[model samples]
Each structure stands twice: as structure tokens, then as C-alpha cells.
Target: MTHTIRNLSTLVELRSNEVEKLQSEVAAKESLRERHQKTLDKLTHLYESSGASGRLPMALALNCGDYKQGVMAMAAHQKVNLSMHEADMAVSQRALTAAYVKREVLGQVLEKHQHAAVTAQRSQERKQHDELATQLWYRGHK
Candidate 1:
């Protein structure tokens, strides 16, 4: 019985550790998600303000004033688009990482639970075996 109790305690400890690890992973992922979202927003805003479209009145005015200025604006817009694409890729990567972490944590917890169940079953079987042996021994003495 004492051994069984010890085994139960160990199982509880493992469960606690798993929970803590999962919580930490969740927090890290959430932080990464927020940072990625902020980066994406900044890139989108930059792209919008670059005036890539020739139809924009401001771009047309710049084209009238200086062909060089219109070209620069277009170049800036292209740079902004590239930045947006990079940010999008980063967001996708971060999201996938978070998902993988979540799955891994879940798997670990499940494994621990399975182990605990097996231990408990073994402990019960041992107790029953011991009880049966004692009963048989007492009957034989009588």
C-alpha cells in the first residue's frame, strides 16, 4: 500500500510538470502571435502609403512633377510589398510552431495519464494477489 501511494504521488508530480510545461508553451505562442500580428499590420500600412498604384492622384501628380519621383514611389511600394510578404511568412511559421507545440504538449500529457492508469492497475492486481495468498495461508493453518 505504501508503494502504491508512492507511485500515485509520482504520477501526480508528472501530471503537474506536464501542465506547467503546456502553460508556458501557450504563453510563448500567444506572445509570438501578437508580435507577428503587429509586424504584419505595420507592413500593410507601409505598403498602402507607398502609393504603388499609378491611378492614385498623388502618384499622378508626382509623375507630372518628376518621373524620377514617380519611379521612386513605385520602388518604395515594391519594397513595402516585399516586407509584407516576409511578415506574412513569419506569421505562418509562428502559427505552425504554436500548433506543433500544442500537439506535443497534449501528447505528453496523454502519455503520462496512460502510464498512471497502468501503474494503478498493476497496484490493484498486486493487492488482490497478496490478499488471496494471505487467505489461503490462514485457511491451511486452520
Candidate 2:
């Protein structure tokens, strides 16, 4: 397809839209990762603070121990989930970078096309003006 200023501008706009969508996707992934990390942190704190009292009666001691164990298991699971989210976020970030680069390149192409068009227009105008001046000079001389 011919790369006129209009066509190149359209391509640039399309690329820009794609970049924006990719950016939003990456941002959502990052936000999800942050929330997952926060949940993991909370799980860690819960695990750490769940220690059984030293002087509990037998039944209560056993119950406290069970609860602490459960907390540990949950924290372990949360850690794994956070790791998965991290991986997802990394993938999203790479995609965003690629899209951004594509958009920038398209924008540069559009800018170059616009500059060329303007230069051509000015050159054409100068030629016309020179021709008009020559016509006027010839008539005045006659």
C-alpha cells in the first residue's frame, strides 16, 4: 500500500490504539501481582503471630497448634500463588514493551511522511511563483 501522509497517519493511530490496550493489560497484571503479594504478606504475618501459648491446657494447646499449622499451610499456598502471578505479570510486561516499540516506530514514520509532504508542497509553490513572475516580467517588457 502507498504510504501517503493520510495512510501513514491511520497506521500510526492503529498502532497507538494497540499500544494503549497493551499498556492497560500490563497495568492490570501489575495491579493483580501487587494484590497477590499483599495477600502473601498478610499470610506471613498471620503465620508468625499464630504461635500457641506456652501454658495452655492440653486441649487448648492442641487446638492452637492445629490452627498454627493451618496458617502455615495457607501461607505456603499463598507464596506459590504469588509466584504464578509474578510470572504472568512478566509476560504481560514483555508484550507491552513490544507494542510500545511498534507504536513509536509507526509514529516516526508518520512524522517523516508529514515532513516530506510539506517540503514537496513548498517546492511546488515556489515553482509556481517563479513562473508567474516570469510571465509578468515578459508582459511588462513588451
Worst 10 residues of 1 by lDDT: 63-72
TM-score of 1: 0.45
* Alpha carbon lDDT at 96, candidate 2: 81
Model 1 Cα lDDT, one tens digit per residue, 69-94? 55446656666655675676567566
lDDT of 2 by residue, 103-135 (tens): 899889888877888888899999999999999
Model 2 RMSD in angstroms: 1.9
Model 1, residue 129: C-alpha shift (Å): 0.8
The per-prediction tally of clashing pairs is: 0, 0
Q: At residue 51, give the lDDT of candidate 1.
A: 56
lDDT of 1 at 36: 55
User: Which stretches in model 1 have alpha-carbon errors above 4 Å?
Assistant: 1-79
Query: CA lDDT of each candidate?
Result: 0.65, 0.84
For TM-score, the strongest prediction is 2
Alpha-carbon TM-score of each model against the true structure: 0.45, 0.89
